[model samples]
Target chain A: MTELFDQVRERVRRNVPVVIATVVGLDGSPPPSFARLGATLVVAGDGPSAGSLGDDALDRVVEADARRALLSGSSGLRRYAVHGAGDGRPAAAAEPESGGLTEASGPTLAVFIHAIEPPPRMIVLGAADVSAALVRVAKVLGFRVTVCDARPAFATRTRFPDADDVVVDWPHRHLAAIADELEPCDAVCVLTHDAKFDVPALVAALATRAGYVGALGSRRTHADRVARLRAEGVAETDIARVMAPIGIDLGGRTPAETALSICAEIVANFSGTPVASLRDGSGPIHRPTRA
Target chain B: MQDILDDIDRWRDEGERVALVRVVAVEGSGPAGPGAAMAVSEHGEVSGSLTGGCVEGAVVAAALEVLASGLPRLCTFGYSDEDAFAVGLTCGGVISVFVEPVG
Candidate 1:
């Protein structure tokens, strides 16, 4: 029912992880399948399940699998062997974690478990020109963007209208408060080119599981920042994770262009793609200027 | 589903029964990955997409069927050399879609 989908949308709006297990396939080889193709079970983390796979027993089995999919934060297909047994479906009765490819005995219920996770976070640690630009791009890329700066004057909602959150707290403290929530999918961009703001921000950003940690500055500034980080006793590996002189070498000078370069680096880094410069690659880079 | 929420909400506001069609599996070279979904109203109005403008017609047909029969169905769309005029993906990739009636 739409109420089930509403529950899913509500949970997603609250940034709570949920899973939708829909019966995508049903094999009636053994006759009388408990699930119909298109039957659905909406499973929320630690919440009551909405809808059903046409059987209480099968719903329990799918609920468990949905919880696991929520934990893994991936959407894919899963399968459970249907049996006219007890009031509940047995997890061990099937592969339990099969990828819907198992040729189990009797009929089978193939459910596509889709995980609805909160959008990945992008915490911009500065509310300057570049920070505002970065928030715009990050939002377009489906990140929950937060722009944090200590100065209330700079970090106004009017300044970064696209940012989801505008915080006037010290950058490092703001990062520390939300550090536990940050995962490898999140990113922290230190657009504060100042040593006072950026140095401590980098220290906190590196400690978190945030996948992309970058500081904006020129080469000379990056070298100085690195030496300062070393002096602060930060580990070499942690220091190395900092993408100072942030962004790929697109050679663009505008704030928007810089933001693109930085976000490009973030995307490339998180996707595990080599951040190789285009100049390093040999071959035609363009489509011959439209002939 | 999130991508098509606005339309789903509008259709729901207008008292329309919607069939939710989701891509459960993609064999190879699918333009959209698994979880790609489309919401279809009982009247065949559609929102969102599953493939690169290829299999939507078939999915809408299936969604309408699910709404009419009140039973969900699994529809597979892929390139079939023998069936010319068949509704399938132009790209050789196969996708398994689940079409269900949603309140």
Candidate 2:
């Protein structure tokens, strides 16, 4: 049991996607039995598994569903009937079955398929004070963070200890090099606050499939930056993707508070929630008073 | 569960029996979603959390009971049940948890 758990921990540490299916509820009213409560099975994306849910047919069914759950990148409880059927009726004996069919019933097995997705990637483009704060907050949210900056002094290991990677290189160059690795679960935050770094960094970031791309600056700065992005041949659609004047309207004053707001926005984006941002709301980015 | 690896290891080394309680399903407005887990030692020491302090006390009592019985049990916490008021989540959600004794 501990060995199986150790394997799960190893995969989690390596950021590999895996699914753990635990049978939480079982209905065996008529005797022969289907699945017992507390039975667990772990399935990985790369065709590896540990433990079992008693029956081979049930394990096979759960493993297939687990793979789908891993691909969907979400976790929830899934109920399946005995003999791998979806309908609450017994399967026919003579019929050629597809193994994952719902053969119109028996006892139901409720397996909670927990999709263990890799930590979402957060690429912080600029190793400034705000970047350090963002890196810390992102780490708390279980993000695999990478801090990039051209200046070697700013992108130091000691400065951003919580960051998973500190690359002392131009942000755009690093982003272009690793563009293929970026996915919908990844985020890119351009915090340079300078046209030189922000434009190129955002251009390259927008090219990737990163789910969230935000830039930190005031309204006037973002307006000027938008023109520069357009001048550099970036499409209007791509420009719209950038969350300028980044973060929620929390009226955050300090760097840490601003970082929290930005992190909250990123979460809101991933979770598909509506949040009042400086980009959408009409007002000063910071409140007149401390409130 | 990963956060409390060291504590679990130390407890196991000391020959303390442990029960792991994991939140398997949440119906609505749960503080934590599926896969949230906690490990409780024989002496009532806890490692992780399954809720925002609404049901931890009841979960601890359930963990102690599982350790005593040496059997796995599935417990549900929510406000819908009249008898479960003392252990239900204040966030108005139903959470099903599985408690199992671990080596």
Candidate 3:
């Protein structure tokens, strides 16, 4: 079990898909020691499984189902009929994707499958000082940070030491190359604050399914950028999705503080929470604390 | 689980046996979702959390049991568990926890 957990953590850190299937409930009696509750089997993308649920046939079925679940990133309970030794047949031979925990009439095996996939990626456009800070903060949040810039001098491993990858290419082009893999959990931050870089990058990023698309600019710059993006034929709905004049109104000026504001927005965006940043609040200076 | 890897690694490095507890299922308004995990060391140290203080005490007891017995066990905690009504989830959700010794 320890080895299984170590492998699970290592694989999750490396962005390798893995699933943990635990026998949480059992129906009907298998052999005296065949299937024990809480017996865990770890099926990972890298290699053979590390533990077992005390049954070979059940393990195989769970592994197959777990791999399938990892592809679409679903996690929940799975039910299989546990055919006893007297039946002399493999359990889970004709299992359905039963989701609920409701009782079953016949013998059943309930395995709770937990799928752990890659951490969401954050593509930071134009590796600036602020981008470096964002990379560090985003890494702490478990995002696979990628720093991209057209200028080779600006994008270097030394500058963005914490980023998972640093690429010297046009920001939009790099984003386009990796766009298909981007999901709603991912984020794209445009920190170039220059039209040439930020405009095209924002356009390409909005085209992707990344959940949070933020651009660093003043109110005046954002208005101009919106007009440019409209000229590029981006949809109004999508344009509205861009977090221009990016981040909450934290009144923070440092690069690290700005990055914190940006990442906080990302967290709120992912969790579907509202950002409570208003300049007109009269009461306490601090917002209500989060537990 | 990802956040507490450093602590678990440190416990292992110090030759301490450890047990991992994972919340495999949650029915209703549980504070945590599935896959939430906690690490318990042989020395009774803990890392991470499995619930919002709903059943942590009972879970630690189960984790310590796994550490001592060298065997895994599944535990269910909720208001329906009459015997453990005191430690039931305040949110009225049922959670299934899998406790296993780390290999």
Candidate 4:
């Protein structure tokens, strides 16, 4: 038990993609009681699981679902019927549980598997003051952050000590190298206002299936960057996906305020929430600052 | 859960038992989302957190019970109850916690 806990702790600390399958509920035959049902299945990409659901067949089914949930980074309740028709009903209600019977006569069980995946990655493409602020805020909000920049001096450990990874390379080049590793839950932010860096980064980021891609710039810079990306053979439709002048319209001028705006935009993008600043809205900050 | 791994590992290595509690679900406005976790060692050392200090004490007690019984459980706390004297989230949000023996 200690070994298993240690392994899980290591994986979680490293931010490796993993899922914990817990049998929350069960029905029929002998319902896996809460004491017996609390088995931890450590799931990684197409790998063997550590724990079981007390039955091999049940483990196989839940493991398959856990893999899918891990890939999608989704968590929800799922029910599988025991000694039933696999429709989440009791065995007698569907078909009689018969040993060595045909497929139609097989019994099923209802097990609720909840997949707990790690937080998403947020890759910030500059180590500027705004990036520093954004990194702190993003960390607080449970994002695994990676800081990237072409200037090694700027993208140092000191600049982004809280970041999961700090890469000193051209933003586009670094992204291209690791594009295959990025998942849909990941995001890319091009905070380098310089067209030389921002334009190429935006072009490369748009190619990925990353959930959000935002570029930092003024209106004039955004227009120019769009033209440059188009010239580089990026389609207009693809270009439309980039959130230029990246952030909610908070009229934020300070670095910290701007970082909040950008983070707010990212949250809105992920949650499908309407983009509105606190000043523009009437709601309390942080659910009335819960005690 | 992720943040307190080092502490959990060190404590477990020293032959200390640990219990883990995770926020599996939440309703209304929650300070932390599902998957937020906290761990308590048999000796009463604690790390990580499931709530904004509003429910950690309750969570620690619940975790100690889970460790002793070796039975995982789901615990809920919020402000919607008429029994206002009971320990609950002062934030008015409902949080479901899962407590299990980690070691």
DockQ of each: 0.63, 0.45, 0.62, 0.31
DockQ score for model 4, please?
Answer: 0.31
TM-score of each: 0.86, 0.85, 0.81, 0.78
C-alpha lDDT of all candidate models, in order? 0.80, 0.82, 0.82, 0.73
lDDT of 4: 0.73
lDDT of 3 by residue, A69-112 (tens): 77877778888776654555544434645866667756677888
Where does model 2 exceed 4 Å of error? Answer: A30-36, A83-105, A281-291, B1-18, B80-82
Residues A230-290, candidate 4: write the lDDT tens digits: 8999999888788767778775677888888888888888888888634233432223323
Q: Candidate 1 docking category?
A: medium
Better of 2 and 4 by lDDT: 2
Error of 1 at A233 (Å): 1.4
Worst 10 residues of 4 chain A by lDDT: A96-105
> What value does the lDDT take at residue A154 in candidate 3?
87
Task: Single out the weakest 10-residue window by summed lDDT for candidate 3 chain A.
Answer: A277-286
Best by TM-score: 1
Put down candidate 1 lDDT per residue, B1-103, tens digits, no spaces. Answer: 5557778878888999999888888887878887887999988999988897888987888899988988877777777434425766777777878888876
DockQ score for model 1: 0.63
Q: Between 1 and 4, whose DockQ is larger?
A: 1
Task: Give the runs in model 1 whose Cα sits over 4 Å from its true position.
Answer: A85-105, A277-291, B41-47, B64-70, B81-91
